[model samples]
Target: MAEVRGRDTWTEELASLIEDSGVRYGGDSPPTSFEVHAPQSESGESLKEQALGFVMAWCEILMELGRGFRDILRQNLINEDSYVVRKFGGPCSKVSKRLRFLNDFLPEDRDPFHAWSVVFFVFILALAAISVDPNREAVAPVVKVRQHPPSASRVLLPDGRYMAYHEQGVLADTARFSLVAPHSFLSSRLAGLPGVKASLLEEYGIRLVTYDLPGFGESDPHPNRNLNSSAMDVLHLVNAVNVTDKFWILCHSSGCIHAWASLRYIPEKIAGAAMLAPMINPYDPHMTKEEMKRTWEKWLPRRKMMYSLARRFPKLLSFFYRKSFLPEQHDEIDKLLSVSPGKKDKLVTEEPEFEEFWQRDVEESVRQGNIRPFIEEAVLQVSNWGFDIKELHVQKKCQTRGILLWLKSMYSQAGCELAGFLGLKHIWQGLDDRVVPPSMMEYIERVLPEAVIHKLPNEGHFSYFYLCDQCHRQIFTTLFGTPQGPVERQEETATAFEEEDKEEVLQVPV
Candidate 1:
């Protein structure tokens, strides 16, 4: 009886509302109480009045919807099989329930789970509790890594500093050619033209010497070090190793700065020089617009930004170095350096042998875990060098200082001799090298016209020079001509190269 009464009551209320609203099955005219009015221009309705009208219209529509829904609910109570009742009891009723439940979960304001904050609060607490390294406070001489076991030979300099060095090829006393190679940035004594084998070096009768720079590998750090000090260190190393004859200097990439110093300060000690993809000051004032454009374009934007920072704002580098290199930054080495490797370079770096050698060398380079040495090296690359590249050309200069001396020179000829490096200068360039652009070679040729430039059409920085035996043979043959066996020990006149001799007396300054 109650269900029948409820259905009858809902039907009567719906019929009365529809009649009052003047809507019927025949589309009959609305009642006198209902009126239609168009908005008038003269009325000039304000923004607030227009907003009120919109709100009133929405309220009427919502009231109608509410009535419809209420009638449907009454039908459900009476088991009247309405559309809403059919949907509620549909086959997918469980799926609908799941959807509604999910929609209510993890809401921003209110949650029924009562456990959402548990994970978040626990995460925050765990993060606060974790501390891998408790000591963050740093002072002078903060070692970034544990001290490594000594693996290289050490030499004590006059300045009470120790230098680490490695020797390869034939015995120094029986060598026809002695090459003193100062390694490039992020390298140590173990990097002697990397891929060139021991037997090949023997066939050429070449004694190769490579050494770690200050604050690198097993070498002691030099206080207030510069390029001049760098050259002097090489000079001290050679004297320590006992190269009886004038030795050649080999340079690659930015490491050429040290060799350039050797050429400038101790020109008399060097026999000749061989440079491969040698880098000069990118910020050199002598660079032409075209040269600058080509050189700077090869680097990625990040690399360029880093170089700019190193050039202008060097003090900020420590913060970056600490985060990257000091904290075991082993991945994407070339990317960090802002260099894009060529196809050949990529192939070489991917090899297991090359990868192993490179990782070990890097370990030795940052073994001390200090950043100052790296900073100084970066600054030196762009800083003012004492001499110019033009000074290296073989030319004669006869100059009189004073007016009187000039007048006297008119009456009598003055003594004039060769003014620059008289020895041979050979440069090997890889065309596809991205680190040192081909424009750099152009600049070198423009300034020092006498330098021999050997262009490798398809070679890259590492591919042509590093660990390739055929390439090594070609380089040796080009430099020394046909290979000859080691010279007799009696014929050698170089200083004694004994393993026990670690210290050399500071006889003559470089």
Candidate 2:
């Protein structure tokens, strides 16, 4: 019984193979019971890779066969006269003088047989035609690629002080875009997205534009600016670039909100948008008072206050903030201070020292005018937006649109994170985020009942590049309805993870 059970299991596994292949045998078809086996199951990979590889290998074999056939024909031609002569023109008069026609004689010159030359010439012509041309046709190269240079630029936004932005990943070299950076600890982290966008364009043609937000890069400290002004920075860039049509928008981290804000002010100008690690609201409603205070104390620097109060107490305050308090909170403060005001800003990561950069910009703004009030107002607006801004989650929508909502390690509130995108199909959220708790994601999922969720296991807040590859495909698919390559595998999965090409998107989600 035990042996029979094992045999039955193997036979059952072969059933589908028999059905698909119509099991055959020597000179006859098999009975219904004949068990044909399918190809062995290896790792749990999608069928796409296997199919492409098979086709590629088969084409290679055909190429080889064509080369081999050409070599055989060349040799056969060179030896043809000699072979015929050796076989038939030996000293044997009884064989008849006509044998010379089939032996060592070229068609016209030797005239082995005057009457039969036409037939022999026709036969040779047919053999050469059949051997060379058809084989060459079978192996002719088919695939071709063309290169187009990108006229991309990274722009600086003045509204929020000095935020970094650039345009990239354009299909035609002519298409342009406005890409916004996410909030994070380092300017480089914000710049990372542009780098990824550039790389993605290299493989898949797409064009975009980007810059840092106020207080993030070379810009002045972002004074108080409403969502409209924040979004208008992009429009201002479009004016600078002199583009007048609907352009694609790539928003990361808190930038999503600004992108959304643009929809109201510049709706007709937007082609599509990609929101990665987007925070529905910049203010985290879930945080307790203690948490908010801690976040502020950890992120806001004294030097920033010096810029704010520098006018009334310029010498004294700048000295104190720059020399003492600001230096103390410099590193962590830079991270928090760089946060973007809208949804889907970039992720936080190790940053270079920002004191020199910030101070230079602060001094420049001070020389230009009172950039402090603008900076202060921007902070106040972000701190206290109307309608319980912290509690409200931004959702996504469009009658016909493409959306990619990539959650980061710190993104805990799931349903609220993307509750706005009611009809979005391609939704991917990192599962093993050390920053945002899994419970938060679960709750978010419950709220977004219909959205498909992709759980990224070995990722974190800064793994933007890792997540960006999937987002890249999803974006192209949405805008052009292109098919996805293959599902990304979970990390550390022994089965097939090692084989996947780890071309981290420039904005690998942490």
Q: Pick the candidate with the highest lDDT.
A: 1
Best by TM-score: 1
Task: Report clashes for each candidate as comma-separated counts.
Answer: 2, 77
lDDT of 1 by residue, 10-72 (tens): 656866875544333322322235343435642456566888999999999999999999886
lDDT by residue for model 2 over 1-510, one digit each (tens)?
A: 776666566555665565555443332223345545545452235377788899999999999999899887667743547575557546445445635534543545655555467767996897578556655434423221222232224455544334444444443323433333333222322343432545545434344455545544434445456666766776777766656666665554445556556654665566555544443332446545554444344223442343334333334433333332223123332333432211121232322323343333333222322333333433433443333322223453222222333332234334333423222323344443432333433443454455345565655434543335665655555554643212221123534444444544434787
Candidate 1: residue 445 Cα off by (Å): 0.8
Stretches of candidate 2 above 4 Å error?
1-165, 169-173, 176-194, 197-199, 220-223, 263-265, 282-382, 386-427, 434-454, 466-510
Give candidate 1's TM-score. 0.67
* TM-scores for every predicted model: 0.67, 0.38
Q: Which regions of candidate 1 fall more than 4 Å away from where they truly are?
A: 1-148, 402-414, 489-510
